[model samples]
Target: MIEDHPQRYALVNELHARPFPSLTVPCQAVYLAVKEPIEAANRDRERDLAHLRALLARHGAAHPAPGATHHSAEIGRHVLKWESHTEFVTYSAFSAGLCERPFDPRGSEVFPTDWLGVAPGKRIAAVLIRVEPLPADMSEVVTKLEDWFVPESLAASWVLDEAAIIAGDFQIDPAGLMRFTVFARPGTGARRVGRIVQRLCEIETYRAMSMLGLGRARDLTGRLNALDPQLSSVVAALPDDHRAAEATLHELLELSAELESLATRHSFRFGATGAYEAIVNQRIDVLRETRFMGRQTFGEFMRRRYDPAMRTVKSAEHRLEQMAERAERAGELLSTRVDVERSAQNQKLLESMDRRADLALRLQHTVEGLSVVAISYYAVSLATYALLPVAEALHWPKSALTAVLVPVTFGAVWLMVRRIRRAMH
Candidate 1:
């Protein structure tokens, strides 16, 4: 018998996880995404689970198993789908019906104000999707679109080989939720309708998440504005021969530290933004949209409005990196200059030490000469004293004897001192 890997089944089953909801036409879905404003990725998973439990309890619904990342349950007349993501949680409720008022927050009772008030995180995105069967006449959609969405920013398209006509303005309604309408062609499968709804929700969710970087980018721009001038001032002074290297080095280091802090603090947000942006684009691409009624498509809408904001984020990220690099390069150059100056000082110190050593050597020789002369004087005096008795017996002068001993004593002392100095050396 062959044994299976521990994760083999789980890994395979993951592909089937979060399958599209089987939704019939004339159904509507209310989707909400919640995320912690700070440290969302590392937020306590238990809190998210408890929040989900709270919602489930409201309808006397069975709770999902512990540690579940996604779940689906029947809550009254609606099917509630809950999913946990890296930094957020989403709750989607699907019901089969039409509301009397389209795109009105009060139209749905799935999310009560009190229940939403108790939610663990802030609402990152909310969407109301109304799916209807395609009408016999196309003008009905156009008429409803103008009434439902802001015409200046509307994006209407026929997607998935014209199986559905999807329209949205990418604007938040007065009720704080985005509105989308899906007109499914006749004979469209329930699963296909569900997929369309899901894609619409994702497009909004990821787009909102991606725009978070714009705020961070704005902050970085201000900081860069201040730091850039300080850095330039310091770098500009580097060429001045009168400017001190140490002072410039200190200023450069401060600039580098601030830039590093900025990069460290915002790296995750910028990276996440890029990933979310790519997902948004990819989701739209899969829709395979074509223009409907000479109106703009999702892609065109993003290119004009959304793309500029994304480009700003990219520009801010790039500018930060370049500033960091520039600071690093300047620091390196200043460090090298400081090292060269230290080397020059060390060289001069060594030269001074060599000159002192030479003078000391000359003084030492002079002291040795004086020492020999002093020692010779004492020796010669002692020799004269001993020879005085002989001089008296031979009737010779003491002065002559002293003079002869002086020459011999001085010569012997000088030779002895030379030998001693050589041995010491």
Candidate 2:
């Protein structure tokens, strides 16, 4: 056999990993999402595997293969589907039939409460969904919706080209569980109904997950407001005093550091929120919803409620980026101002040194003049003594000879000093 890439089989199997459950009509499902305080990207997969193993052990069912992120198991009278994601895990149990009373608690009792309490993470979302066979007339559907869900908050639609009618109030009840109902038309295959139900579950889950970013954005807004004015004040001072600019630069650096820290800490969550939001929208679009009872559909409800919160998150992310840019610009401007001030100071220093150098040159000229006069006097005295011996022979006066030699000696000394100065230069 030809060698293949090591991950080829695994990558191919991933497409079929989370297949839709073949759910029948006239049944109910319980969906629960669990999330940790920390992200699951670096979480311990062994812990999740252990939890799954524990649940499997309770039902004497086969364990899921190691490293599996999705599993479906039969637990006594119901079917359980578990999927692990980057930030959370979801558990969905589908039972064979509905309970006697509408919205009864028995349908959700498939998983023992004790087991749920010991799960690895806190519950993020809990939902109860009922799938029923559609009746002949639209009047019965309308009456059932009014009785089951809140009128003002109801979001109902005909999905899958009217192959199924789906409705939800999108509100939490006393049990802290959101409720949904799907009425599948006759001749709709089990797999198709299952796909519709799974899509609805995913829409709810991803919608709730995406809202986490909004909560973080709200928390950061106060800090951002406080930082804004401080940054503005620092930048306002940049053009004036260099000393003050230095101080302001320090503050700007601190602010920039804080902004970068915040960005690093929350970047993953913000990005994940965007991804999950897109998934929610994609699932809703695939539903191809049409209006029901002239009420708002799921897509409309998301637009009205969920869209605003996502906008807030985007606004927060953008605000952080703007503040960081402002800090960087302020630092650059302050640095330039400091450089100019240093250059001006250096110019003044050079001018002072020039004045001192000129004074030193004048003092050296005075010393040279004194040295010439002293050397000329000494040379003339020596010449007079030497010519005294010759005066007796030539009958010449020593004083006159000395007087003649005095001017010549002074000239000779001056010339020698000038020559030495030129050679040194």
Best by TM-score: 1
TM-score of model 1 (CA atoms):
0.94
For every candidate in turn, the CA RMSD to the true structure comes to 2.0, 3.3
lDDT of 2 by residue, 1-425 (tens): 99999999989999999999898888888999988778757788778789888988999988989998999889988899999898888989988788888888767777678988888888888899999999999999999999999999899999998999999999998878899999999989899998988988999899999999998898788889999999898888776554465677788889889988988888988998899999999999999999987989999999998999999999998998899898888888887877887798899999999999999999999999999999999998898888788876888787778878999999999999999999999
* Per-residue C-alpha lDDT of model 1 across residues 138-251, encoded as one tens digit per residue: 999899999988999999999999999999998887788899999999999999999999999999999999999999999999999999999899888887779999999998
TM-score of each: 0.94, 0.87
Worst 10 residues of 1 by lDDT: 100-109
Distance from true position, residue 21, model 1, in Å? 1.3
Candidate lDDT (C-alpha), each:
0.93, 0.89
